[model samples]
Target chain A: SQQGEEDPQALSIQEGENATMNCSYKTSINNLQWYRQNSGRGLVHLILIRSNEREKHSGRLRVTLDTSKKSSSLLITASRAADTASYFCTPGGSGAGSYQLTFGKGTKLSVIP
Target chain B: DVKVTQSSRYLVKRTGEKVFLECVQDMDHENMFWYRQDPGLGLRLIYFSYDVKMKEKGDIPEGYSVSREKKERFSLILESASTNQTSMYLCASRLAAYNEQFFGPGTRLTVL
Candidate 1:
């Protein structure tokens, strides 16, 4: 079963524009993480926002968590052509001393130059 | 740099054949995971191991088995391959304390 569901299945924008993707999960999570994947490549971890944290930023990536609503969002500021890829949100929870994460169907962002 | 390597970037196999996918990590991370990615469905975890010889099934573990005989290596085995089993296989590892996971280049498997 998929724990997270990302909205805006696909998005297209011009270079330098901002792109935002949202995710909603069903269960309580210890942290929410964002990842990027280029075509034919493995996923790269972008940032992690813990349950206690409301927001986090790294480079041009900003992540906000609303635990009360069981939702999270990733915002990319000034996106570029290089930013065209699939963005995934993973909600992680720990059980019996091990952490388990489930990834949602990603939001495919296309940045046209 | 943390490096995770898979045995092959692409593989073609016949139906009913036993297939093995290998993964190795150089970072000495304690937790390793195997996931399969497909169109629309995204990535689904097949199995994970926290330590040598200790394995646990993930959400979609049917038709898949895993082996973790060594600390640095993890192997996912397909008991008998089928056309439906063809997908991109990804391997990832993370430290016990960290939430970030490092992933290997995926293997695109085609079962004919």
Candidate 2:
């Protein structure tokens, strides 16, 4: 399985603090995406970074990808209580017409207000 | 807004009984996928459909099968429910392989 493995299975931080999670995969990927899931709910896509891209940001979320290391990281700055949820990293392959993604066990983040 | 709807939010079945889970997407997506999420296993793909009648097996397709008779609907079938099959099942759809997928609220199945 070329599934990505997230570091720090769980994290806790006070509101206004930064939270960072890392993911490492074993194979080359075409893109990596970050998704957030509320308790017992479907996941919502947060961001997508292509293999060629090194870094991207959206609002308080920042994503960095390193193809050389087959790793990526997600940074949430000034996280709020609402940001308490599970985060997953999905690495997509370059296969034609194959949009299948391998998801890793997510990082559970808790933001205390 | 893209919306994916599952047939049920919760289901219970007995061993040896047949079970069916339905999913429908309103986004006219060309790719649809079914996955089962377990506590420590993350999300494991069960099956996917690329077109109206084209279906493909995913990583763990042993005891599951799928049907895609229409573009908007996909169905997962468990030939005979078993205790080990209890888990949360999720349905997702995307316009293409690289596009962001929209997922439905999962169905939590309990096999007894």
Please report, in order, the local distance difference test score of every candidate based on alpha carbons.
0.90, 0.91
* Residues A1-113 of candidate 1: C-alpha lDDT, one tens digit per residue: 33678889999999999999999988777888899999755589999998999999999999999999999999999999999999988888756533567787889999999
lDDT of candidate 1 over B1-112, digit per residue (tens): 8999999999999999999999999989999999999997889999998889999899899999999999999999999999999999999998873368999999999999
DockQ of 1: 0.68
Worst 10 residues of 1 chain B by lDDT: B93-102
Q: For candidate 1, give the lDDT of residue A70.
A: 97
As a whole number from 0 to 100, the lDDT of residue A46 in candidate 1 is 94
Q: After superposition, how far is residue A94 of candidate 2 from its true place, in Å?
A: 0.5
Show the colliding residue pairs in model 1.
none
Query: Where's the lowest-lDDT run of ten residues in candidate 2 chain B?
Result: B94-103
Q: Write the per-residue lDDT of candidate 2 for residues B65-106, one digit (tens) a residue.
A: 999999999999999999999999999998988777788999
Native-referenced TM-scores of chain A, all candidate models: 0.92, 0.94
Predictions' DockQ, in order: 0.68, 0.73
**Regions more than 4 Å wrong, model 1:** none
TM per candidate, chain B: 0.97, 0.99
